[model samples]
Structures are given as C-alpha cells and as structure tokens.
Target: MALSFDGYKLTEIINPNGHCTQIGFTNENEPDVKKRGVILFDRQIRYIEVEEHQKFKRVKVYTTKDAEPMDFDFLEDNYANFDLFLRSIYNQ
Candidate 1:
C-alpha cells in the first residue's frame, strides 16, 4: 500500500525477504485513532525496514507521523540462519 503525506510517499513492506506481501498503512495522517476506533490500534501500525551495515544488522520500526524510531533486540542463542528468524513470525 502507498500513501501520500506531506508531499512524500509511504509504503508498507511485508514479509519482505525482498519479495512478499507487506502489511501496514502508508498514510501517516489519517488519524488512525479515528479510523481504527481504538487507541491501541495505533500500536499495530509501523514502518519497518531491515538494513545491513558494516557493523551490525538492524531492524527498525518507525512509530508516529514524526517517524520516531524504536529499536528491538533479538536474542537468538540457537537460531542457525536469518531466514529462520523471519519464518518464526508464523509460529511454525
């Protein structure tokens, strides 16, 4: 999905192992509180991106229209590969 806000475009990247259906709203100003009819629904929305750098792997989540960033740590002591990490979201 794509949304135009403040002259820029926002898009959802879902299950993206580089190619897959992403789930999220691109609109940043649609007043999710009003549209969703609940305050907690706002937490369900996020802009996700995975980046690889020279030092570390990063999975970033952007919350709010201002694009405030929240970071999460994955403690994978037994996982063997990165693909397994993504697949774990399915609970299999």
Candidate 2:
C-alpha cells in the first residue's frame, strides 16, 4: 500500500523473505532526494542512515499529515537487505 507524505509517496516494498515491509519515499521533482525506512505495526517509523555523500541528511518520516515529527535511528541489524537497498539507492 502507498500513502502520500511530504509531497512524496510512501510506498511499501514487498519482501519475500519476511513479513515486515520497508517503506520508501523519493522526491519526484528531485530524484536525488529520498528516504527509505520502515513502519511498525503500531505506526512507529525509522529511516536508514544516509551517508555523508548523499544529497539529503537524516530527517523525520511523517506517515500522515498532522502526524508528530519524530526522530528515528538508522536501520541496523534488522532488515539487512532493506538497509542495503537504502545504501544502493543513495549511492546512485
């Protein structure tokens, strides 16, 4: 499923390996700007860390309008593939 957030679409990535899914958002007007993360079943959000070379820095992931601005940590041991996905995209 997909939802609109901060002028971008937060879409769920289907993973064959697990039940958890990763959500990603990219700037359509500026492809270089993007973020990939996950939303817990209870609605908590966490984004993967962008390297220093990436165009955008760490930022909040608002799942909905009027949602509270929240600080998130980089994806670590969990969802290793998803973490790689974020790195690959930012590298591009």
Candidate 3:
C-alpha cells in the first residue's frame, strides 16, 4: 500500500500473520520502517480495524457509526477499556 503524508510517499505491503498483521513500509528502495500491530476486528466483524503501535498510538481505521457492527460499547462507556485492550495485546 502507499501511504502519503504531506508530500513524502510511503509504500507498504500487507504481510499477514497467523492472527495479527504486519506492514512493511518501504522508502527509497530500502526498508524504511516496520509497523507491527494487531487487527482486532476486520470490517466484516466490526466494520473497523483497531491498530496500536505499542504505546505509540491507538487508531481506528475505516471507522464510521453506520459501518459499526454493533453499538459502540467500550467507547460509549469505558474509554479506558480501549486503552487497556491495546496494552494487553501489545504485552502479549
């Protein structure tokens, strides 16, 4: 995949793991970076993918209220639950 921020373009490929997934970002023909994270729920299950970069960031991709599989639980009540979830996954 190609990721562009501002003007710099970053390309990556999807290297799926058994459970989680990995992204190989390439720049200037060299391995620019490696982003390892978990795909907790795909669009099929929850209509969103939550990825955390181990204390760096917790982001929800392709997220929309209508696309949500069910009513938002953790976000509606305990926002901390999401943080805890990320921590647990990263620790494992």
Computed on alpha carbons, the lDDT of every model, listed in order, comes to: 0.36, 0.42, 0.34
**Better-scoring candidate (TM-score), 1 or 3:** 1
Candidate 2 lDDT by residue in tens digits, 1-92: 33335455434444433334345655577676666554433233334333332333333443333355533323333345445544443432
The number of clashing residue pairs in each candidate reads: 1, 0, 1
lDDT of 3: 0.34
Candidates 1 and 2: which is better by lDDT? 2
Q: Largest lDDT belongs to which candidate?
A: 2
TM-score of each: 0.31, 0.28, 0.23
Q: Rank the candidates by TM-score, best first.
A: 1, 2, 3
How would you encode candidate 3's per-residue C-alpha lDDT over 1-92 as one tens digit per residue?
21222222223323343344332222343345433222332332333455444343333433233442321123234346555444433434
Model 2 spans with C-alpha error above 4 angstroms: 1-4, 16-19, 39-92
Tens digit per residue, CA lDDT, model 1, 1-92: 22222311222223443323333223345544222111112344466666765544444545455355433223243223334434433323
The candidate maximizing TM-score is: 1
Which of 1 and 2 is ahead in TM-score? 1
- TM-score for candidate 3, residues paired by index: 0.23
Candidate 1 C-alpha error for residue 77, in Å: 7.9
